[model samples]
Target: MTSGDVSLETVTAAKAGDRKALEDVLAGLQDRIYSLAMRVLVNPDDAGEATQEILIQILTKLSTFRGESALSTWAYQIAVRHILNARKLRDRDLGLTFEMFATDLETGLVADPPAAPDQALLLNELRISCTMAMLLCLTLELRLAYVLGDVFEMDHAEASRILELTPAAYRKRLSRARAEVIAFTSQHCGLVSNQAKCSCPRRLPAALKSGRIRSGSYPNSAGASVDYAAAKQQIASVVDDLKTFKLQQAVPGQMCPEDIRGRLTRMLSHPL
Candidate 1:
């Protein structure tokens, strides 16, 4: 079915209490819903729970929907509110002050290495993940503005309506969010540069003269025999660890603070 037809059908079935139709609607929109939840919650587990809650809310409240907006938009509204509430609960449960999370993120970035020239692809993925994690710490108003405007590429007027804020208010929130993200990226870039300077081997020319440079068609003087598969596996592990860290942060209830700390310690002990 075309999107419009499917939407209309879902609405009709939803109004008639057809559970399968509701499921179909949710299944069709799961990616968008999950992406929004993940962007706001910054943890898979929390995002998963938030997704479930949002789906339930959509089903229960389907009858109340005035049809003033598209079903997708209305569902998005519900998802956004659910994420906001989940974040609040997570913060309260962990006894975490927003300042603490922000400080930790700042400190983590400082200690992180710069993007490797050869690892540019992996680094870009990490950068996107870091940006999403940062979004989790933003206020709901700002988070919605950023996700809708920046991530989803929504127009200011549309975002304003979704956020139920004046265009000026939305603009302010978008401005703040953009500024925060840019500042974070700038700091991160500095950290990466410093790390590369410190850790990267010095005197590639001298190394080549000494026959220490490996025979590789690739640049960066890496040996052709370099275990790219192993290296990739290691990077994947680190990404997984980071994902777990994000999940812990997003859903603290899933793991005790001590458990989270231990996991982080182990991850750090093993260098990326």
Candidate 2:
């Protein structure tokens, strides 16, 4: 749910110990929290764990939420802070560098790739997985800058506030992130340039054989069928490099599994 969907009355009630209102408040923010975490962390398991911890932090601090900013902004600020510190506290590392990722993209590419299989959304899986994987190459700070500033299309002021940076500082970080991403994609990704060696179709076979994507098991498929060429053409039609990355925002938000979600709510009652 969007921030606009969460009412001020609900926030007030939640802050005042209304259980139902607390649930509503957290519910409105969960998907957004998960989405941001997924983009920054690039692992479903990591994002899920992060979402739970972030939500719990929000819950504990709900009373202090003075409402000076929008609830979504407050929530996002909390999420960003938590994720940035989480790596240090937990010793978590994805260990991806741009040079390594560039090599990975070029590896196992099919020069004359066979036709994309039409069975249950393999192409979409490959497309989404590759795009998400690309973000892993960036440092967490830059990745968050790109996800908040570009993928979500958040306003500069709002994004800066969430990132807790001055507007100029935020812009500089985003510029660096945008430049790094655009430079890599422009030279390598077929969606940004036809001359690029790696297209989704060319990568599909290696992805399947490597067990990166199993056939018909993608949990978040959006369409009955995906036209690889059409999608590439549509994304490539945009002339701007930064704008081209925006088109890749089709990666669906990750959600917590039901059992984990239920456990999150139970935290309120159990106080763990």
Best by lDDT: 2
As for model 1, its CA RMSD to the true structure in angstroms is: 14.3
Clashing pairs in 1: 114-192
TM-score each candidate: 0.58, 0.91
Whole-model Cα lDDT of every candidate shown, in order: 0.52, 0.78
lDDT of 1 by residue, 46-80 (tens): 66666666766766687887777667777787877
> Least accurate stretch of 10 residues (summed lDDT) in model 2?
220-229
- Model 2 quality (TM-score): 0.91
Q: In model 2, where do residues sit more than 4 Å from their true spots?
A: 1-4, 88-90, 114-120, 220-230
Which residue pairs in candidate 2 collide?
none
User: After best superposition, candidate 2 residue 110: deviation in angstroms?
Assistant: 1.7
Q: Give the alpha carbon lDDT tens digit for every residue of 183-267 in model 2.
A: 8888888777778888777887888888887886775444424444455666765776744575456566666567667987887
* Candidate 2: Cα lDDT at 9: 89
lDDT of 1 at 91: 71
